[model samples]
Target chain A: MNIPLNITKTIHDWLFSIMPEGVATVTEWVIVAAAYLALFAVAGLYLVLLERKVAAWFQLRLGPNRVGPWGIFQTMADALKLVSKELTSNANIDKFLYNLAPYFVILSSLIAIGVFPFSRQFQALDINIGIFFLFAVSSIGVIGILLAGWSSNNKFAMIGAMRSGLQTISYELSVGLSMLTMVLLTGSLQLSEIIEVQRTGGWLILQGHIPAIIAFMIFMIAGTAETNRAPFDLVEAESELGAGFHTEYSGMKFAYFFLAEFINMFIIASIAVVLFFGGWLSPFGITDDITWFPETIWFVIKVLGIIFLMMWFRWTFPRLRVDQLLTLEWKYLLPINLVNLVLMAIIIWLNWTI
Target chain B: MSYFSDIYNGIKTLLTGMSVTGGYFIRARKGSITQQYPDNRETLKMFDRFRGEVVMPHNENNEHYCTGCQACEIACPNGSIEIVWDRQVDPETGKKKKMIDKHIYHLGMCTMCSLCVEACPTDAIVWAQNYENSVYDRKYLTKVLNQPGSKVKAGIED
Candidate 1:
C-alpha cells in the first residue's frame, strides 16, 4: 500500500477531500473503471497491429504501411471499417445469447488485465487470490465462445465453439499445474508477492532452474492453447471452421471478438512475465537504482518479449489437427506438467533450489 | 523411458521450427521481399524480356517497320489485334501499294501469348515493358499501336 507518490492514490485522496465519503468512493471507482476501459481499448488495438507486424516479419513481408506511418493507425482504420459494416442478422438464431456472448468474452479479458501488477504503483487490484482469480475469470471466456457458436444457428459455428471449449478446458489443467509449480516456489498466489520473491531470488526460471524451465515451457504451450491460438488453434481452424465460433458475428460485434483475442494474448503474456520472468524486476539487479527507467517499463518490455514469442509460435507452426491438439494436452502437456509439479515440490522440500 | 523421449523430441522439433522463423524475423530488415508498389514506382524497372504489352516501335523519323502483312492479325487467337490497310499510290514508284492505315490492339482481350510478336515478319511489334495497362473505361483499352504521324519505313519492301 506504500506506493511512492502513485497517481491513483493521489487522485483518490484529492477526490475524497472534495466530496462526501460515500459519494467519493463511488465516483472514484467510476473514474478508475473508465480509465481501465480507455487504457485497454487502445492497448487491444495496438497489440493486434503488433501481432500482425510480427507475423509479417516472420514471413519476410511488410505487414501494414498504408493507414499511417509504418501503418501505426492500421488497426484504427480496421476498427472504422468494422464499425461501418452492417450487422447481418438471421431469424433462426437465438437473439439473446447471440448478443450476450461478445460482452462476456471482452469482459473476461479486460477484467484479467486489471489483476496485473504493471509497476509498484500501477496495480488496480492486488488481491491475495490474484493468480487464482486470473485463471477462474479467463476460463469463462471459453463459455462466451461456446454461447456464440451455439446461438449462431450455424453448424460450423457450433463446431468451432465446441472445439474451443474442449481445447480451453483440457489445456487449463496444464496451465494451472505449471502455475502451481511456480506457486510452490514463490509460496504465494498474490502476483505482487510473486514478483517480490523473484526480486530477492532472481527470476524463477533462473532460481528454480530445471523444474521452473520445464514449468515455463509447459505453461507457454498450454497458455497458447488456452487462448485458442496456433498451433493448438483447432477452434477456428480457418481451413475447416471458416472463423470458428464467431463466424456468424460481423461488424462491431465481430470486432469485439477480435479485440478480445488480442487482449487475452496480452493478459496471458502479462501473467507469464509476472510468474516466470519476474514482473518489474530488473535483470541481474542492473536497473535497481536507475530511477529514470521505471519498473513499469521493465514489465512492459518483458511482456512484449513474451508476446513476440507467442507470435513466433503462431507463424512458425501449422495448425494441429483436433486429435493432435487433444493428444498434445492429454498425452504430452498434462503428464509433463504433473511430473514437473512433483519435481518442484521435492526441490522445495529438499531446500535444493537456488 | 519412451515417454520421456517423446516429450524431449516434441520440444526439440518445436524449437527447431521456432528457430527457422526466428532467424527470418531477425533477418527481416535485410531480407524482406516486399515490393512497396506505388512508392517505388519511380525506381521500378521491368525485365527486358518481360512481355507486358505489344507495341509498334517508331523511330525518330516518325516511321515504323509494319507492312500491314496481317500475319499478326491472323495469329491472334482472341482477335485482339486489328490491322487496317488501304491501297495507296506510291509517289516514287507510281504504283498502288498496300499501306497500313492503323494497327489497333485491344489490351482487355489480349492474352499476352506472344503469338503476334512471333508471327510479325519485320519485327514491327515487340513487347513493351509497361504492364500498367488498367484504364477506367473498357474502350480506353483499345489502343492504336502505331504512333500518330508515323508511316512505314521507306526502304521496307515485300
Candidate 2:
C-alpha cells in the first residue's frame, strides 16, 4: 500500500489539469452536487411518472403516458409547470427560518453526495472519516425539516416536521450504530477501506454471520425511514398533513426540497452499498478482474438495484400510520439493531468472518 | 429490570412489526406497473359518463342543429367556450338570421362539467369520447362545427 509521492503528485497534477481551475475543491464539490441535482431531477421525474403508472396499475387504470414516449417526459412537464407557478408563503410565521429550513435540509442532503464511492478513487473528497462524516452530515437535514415545521406557524407542518425529526433521529441512532459495528470490525472509518474490507472478505450481506445480517437490515430500513419515503412517510402524509413540512413553500424552494428528497434517497442507497451490499464490488468479484468495466459501473449497478428496490417498496404499499411508524421504529428496529451489534461483536470474537 | 426493559421491549414489538413489513416486502407484485397512455389510447376504454370534450353532431344530411344560441358560451364557468357567429340572409324568408356559425372551445380550459351541452337548447354540442387533447399552441383548440359557406338549413334560426 506504499504509493510513491511522485505518483500522488502526478495524480494531483492530472486532476488539477483535467478539472476546472479556481476553487478546485469547491468546483469538484459543485460538480458532485450538480451531478446529484441532475440525478434528483431525473429520479424525481422517473419516481413521479412511475408512481402515477404504479398507482394506475394498482387501480386498474392507465397512467400518464401522453407527455413523452411512455410518458417519460410527463414528470419533466409537470416540473416545468410547477416551476412556472407562483411560489406563495401565506402565514405570518418566522420568515427567515421558514425560508432557511428547506435550504438546510437541501444542503445537508446534497452534502451527503460527496461521500459516495462512485468508482475506485473517484469521490469528491477522499476524507478519512468519510462514512461517519456522511452519517453526521446527512442527519442535519432532520433539523431543517423540524425548523421548517416550526417556522411555518402552521400546526400540521409543525407536527409533520416534529414527527419527521423524531422519527429520523431515532432511526439514525441505529444507522450510526450499525455503521459503528462495521468500523469496529473493518477498523477503518473511510468508505474506501470499508469497500476494501468487503472486497477481500466479501460484502457484509454475505459476511455469513448473524450480526452482519442484522446490521444490514437495520441500515436498509433505517435508511428508508431517513429518506422519508413511503411506509415511513408520515412527514407529509397527504391525507392528513397537506404535503407535510413544506406545505407553504412553492416554486424553486419547494423544488429544492423535492430534489433533496430524491438525492437523500440516492445517498442512503450508496451508504447501504458501501456499508452492506458492496461498493462497486461485483458478484463473486468477477468484475473486479475485468479491466474494461471501471469500478464505477459496478457501483452504479448496485446503487441502482437498491434504488429500484426502494422504488418497488414505495409503489407497493399504503402509507403506514404515525403510531405504526413509531412502533416499527422504537418498538422493532432499535432493539434488533442493538442486539445485532452485540451479536456482531461475538461473531468477530469467534473470528467467523465471511 | 428497567435496564433491559427499554430495548428488549422494543425488540419484541419490532419483531412483531417487521413481520408485517417483511410480509409486505415478500408479497409485493412481481411485475412492472407502468402504463403507456397515448400508445394504447385507441384500445383504452372510458366509463359510461366520462365527459371529455364538446363536439357538434354531424348528421347524414350534413346539418348541425346549433342555431346561433349562445347558451353554452354563457353557461361555461371557466370561459372555455367561444362561438364564431356568421350572419346569413335566409332564402325562404328574405330575412337576416343569426346562424350558429363556428365553435372554438379551449379544451385546456374545459372543466368537462358538461354545462355547455346542458345549456345548448338545440342539443347541437355533445360530449365527444376523445380525451387525448394534447396541443402545442393555444390557437388550434377551437373547433369549427359547420363547414364554411355550407348553407344553414332553410328556416333553422334559434
Candidate 3:
C-alpha cells in the first residue's frame, strides 16, 4: 500500500528523536486519541444540525435558524440542555447495566472512527484488519442497546431492544456480504489498501459498474439498518416503543446515546466512501495537478454525499414493520447480496474490473 | 420471475419516493413555507377580517361613537366587556345622559367570538386584527378600548 505523507509521522518522528522512546510512544498515543476524540465530538454535534436542516428541507420548511447563523449551534444548545437535565431513574431497575449502556454504545462508535482514512495523511491507524476491525467494533454497540433495554425494566424498551438485536444480527450479514463484493475487487481487507486499489481502477462503483451498483445499494440498505436509522428504525419506532432502548436514560447519559447515533451514521458513510468511492482520491484525478488542494477535501465531499443520501433515505422512507424489517434483510437483501457476490466473483475471475 | 420483479418494484418505488424528497430539497430555497415570524413582523399583515381583539375606533380628535348603550356588555357570553357610565346633564338637551367613564375589555376571557362586534348598534367596536396580545400578567390583558382623553362625539338628533 502507498504510504502518503502524513502529519502523524512527522509528530511521531519528532517526538522519538527528542524524548525517550517509551515516553514518546505513550505521548503520541495520547495526542492521537485526544485529536480523534475532539474531531468527532465537533463532527457529531454538527451532523445532528445537518440532519435537522435536511429533514426540514425535505418537508419544505426552514429549520433551526435561531441558535446561531442558520442555527449552526442548535445542537450545541441541545447538548447544553441535555447535560443539565436530571438523571431520572426507576427505583426497581438494574442500576449498574442501565448506567453502563450509553457509554458502551458511544465508545464502540468512537473506536470505529479511528480506522477511517480521512485522507492518506489523516488516518489514525492503517491496521491490516481495518475493515474487519470496524465491523467487529460497530456490532458491539448492539450489546449496549440490549443491555439498556433489559436493565430498564420496561416492556416497550425490551421489545425495542429485541427488535434492534434481531434487525442488526440479520442485516449485518448483508452488510458484510455486500462490502465483501467490493473487497473482492480490491483484494484486500485493509481499508487503506482498498482505497489504493480504487485510486488506479477509479471508484469501485464505476469500476465494477453493475455489480458494484448492486453491492452499493445492498450495503447502504444494510448499513442504515445497522445504524438503526429510519426505514429500518423499528428499534425506536417512537409510535410503538416510546423512544426505544434508551427510554430510561436521561441527562448526559441519554446525550451519549444520542451523540453515538450521529457518530455511527458518520462512520457508516465514511466506510461507504472509503470502500466504494475513492477515499481521498480526487475524481478522474482532476485535483492531482493542483498541488494546493488538499486530498482530505475530496474525502469529506464524498463522505458528505453518502451522508446526504442516507439522510434522504431516513426522511423519505417510513419505518418498516417488525416482520417486514426481517423479511427485507432475509428475503430481499440476503438473496440479492449472494447473487451480487457470485457475479462479482465471476467478474474478478475474468479480470473484468477497470 | 415474480420474486425478481418484486425486488425491482421495491427499488423503483424507493427511488420514486427519493426523487420526490430530492426535488423538494433542491427547490427548498425558493419554496420553503417558513415565514420567520418575528423577523418578518414589520411586513406581515393579518387578514382584514381576522377577529383579533375588540377595539373602539376614534378619529384623531379623540371623539368616539360609543353612547354607553351597554349593548356589547350584554352581548358578551363570557362577561368580557363592561361599560361603566355616570349620569351627566347634557348641555344641549337639558337631560340626564349616561356618559361612559371607562369601557373595560377583559381580553383574557374573550374567545374572539365577534358576538360583541355584531351586537353593537352604533358600530362602536370592531376587530383590531392585532393578534399579538400576549402579556405576562392576566390583569394586563384587561384593556381599555377607548384611548385616554377620548369622548363621545356630539350628534344632531341624539
Candidate 4:
C-alpha cells in the first residue's frame, strides 16, 4: 500500500532535477496569471455567442448570423463598435467609482477563473482550497456592482444594484452550501481532487441519493442567480430601469460590465461542470480507454454545454419578480441546501466510499 | 395533501405554458408573413400599386401633373414638401405662365400619407412602391423632382 523508500528517493530526485531556478519561479507565476487573463477574455466572447444562439433558438428567431459563421464574430464586431464609440459621462455620476466599477467586476470574475480546474494538470494555480476560493472571488463581484449603482446617484441604478446584491448574496448561500456537500464527500476543497474522486468512482450525479439530487438542482438555480441571468435578472430589468447600473456610463466602460457578466456566466457553468459532471473525464470508459484523446477538449465541450444550457434558461423563461426571487431563495432553496449539507455529512460519516 | 396538490399545480402550470408555446410552434411555419424587404426585395417584387412613396411620372415632355398649387405641402403635417416655380412663356399665346420649377420632397420627413396625392388636381404623381429610402447626409435628403436638366415638354398635344 506504500511506496518503497528507494523508489520514493528516486522520484524526489527527479522532481528536484526538473525544478527551475528562483527567477524561473517568478516567470512561472507571471505566465499563469497572463494566461488566466487571456482565457477570461476568450470565455467572455464565447459566452456572448452562446447567449445569442441559445436566445435565438428559444425565441424562434435568428439572433446574429451576419458577422461570421454562426454569428461567432458578432461579439468582435460589437466590441469594435463599442471601442469606437464616444466615452460620455453626459449625466452626473461619482466619476472615480463609476469609472473604476467595471474593472473591479472584471478583476473579480477573472480571479475566479484561477480557482476552476480546466483539466487535471491544466489549472494555473491548483490552490488547495479551490472551491472556497472560487466562491470568495465570486462573492466579491457584487461589491463592484454596488459601488457602480450607489455611486451613479441615480435611483434606478441604486435600485438595480441593490436588487443584484441581495439576490446574489441570498442565492450564493445555497450555491456555496451545495458546493460544500461535494467538498465534504471528497474531503478536499480542491476541485481537481473532487473530479478525481468522481472519475475513479463515478460522477456524484450518478450516486443515487435524494439529497445529492436536490443539491444539484439548487446549485443550478443558484448558479443562474449568481450569473444575474434571466428568471433572476431583475437587476437589469430593461422594462423597469432604463439599463440598471450602467445607465449613465457609456462606451467601453459600459462594455466592460457586459463582458464581465458573460465571463461570470462561464465561471458559474464551469463550477457546475467541475463539481457535478465529471470535469475533463469522459462520460464512461469510452474516454478513459483512449489514450490519444485529449482530456482538455472533453472538458471544454462539457463547460461549453453548461454555458449553452445557462443561455437557454435565460431565453426560454421570463424573469422573476424581486419578491419572488427572494422567496425562492429564502423559503425553498436555502432550506434544501442546508438539509443537503447535513445529509451529506451523515453520508460521509457512514463511510460511503466506493 | 399539500405536497400532492403542489405537484399537481406545477404540472398544470407547465402544461398551460406548453400549450401557448404549442400554438406558436405550429404557426411558426407562417413566419409572421413579413417581406424581409432588404434581403428578398428583388424576389417578392411588390406591385407598383403597393401604396409606398409617390413618384411623379414624367412624360416625353417630363411635365408632371403637379401645378405648384401647394396642396401637398398644406396637406403634409411634417413639412416634407417644397414647391418651387418660375414663369414660362407660352409660345403660341406669347403669354407669361406660372410653371412648376421643381417639387422637392424630403422622404425622411414624409409619413407616406396619401393626402398630397389625393389633393393633386392632376393625377401625375402616384404611389410607386419604392420603399427603400434609407439615406445619409440630411442635406442630400431634400430631393428635387424636376431637376435642372429635366427637359419637361409642357406644350399641349393635339
lDDT of 2 by residue, B1-158 (tens): 66468657856765666455545445334433333345567687777677877887766677777787789999999988888787878777788878766777787788899988988887878887777787898677765656664545544553
Rank candidates, TM-score, best first: 1, 3, 4, 2
My TM-score estimates for the predictions, one after another, are: 0.91, 0.70, 0.90, 0.83
Better model by lDDT: candidate 1 vs candidate 2:
1
* Cα lDDT listed for each candidate: 0.90, 0.77, 0.90, 0.76
Clashing residue pairs, backbone N/CA/C < 3 A, model 3: none
Clash pairs for candidate 4 = B61-B152, B61-B153
Q: What is every candidate's C-alpha DockQ against the true complex, given to 2 decimals?
A: 0.75, 0.11, 0.74, 0.20
Residue B100's lDDT within candidate 4 is 75
DockQ-derived CAPRI band for the predicted complex in model 1: medium
Give the fraction of native contacts in model 1: 0.83
Q: After superposition, how far is residue A166 of candidate 1 from its true place, in Å?
A: 1.1
DockQ-based class of model 3: medium
Instruction: State the lDDT of candidate 3 residue by residue for A263-352, as single tens digits.
Output: 999999999998889898998999887766778888889989999999999999998898888888888889989999999999989988
For candidate 4 chain A, the 10 contiguous residues with the lowest summed lDDT are A1-10
How far in Å is the alpha carbon of B58 misplaced in model 4? 1.3
Measured over the true interface residues after superposition, the C-alpha RMSD of each candidate is 0.6, 7.2, 0.7, 4.0
Q: Give me the candidate number with maximum TM-score.
A: 1
TM-score of 3: 0.90
Best DockQ among the predictions, by candidate number: 1
Q: How far in Å is the alpha carbon of B53 misplaced in model 1? A: 2.7
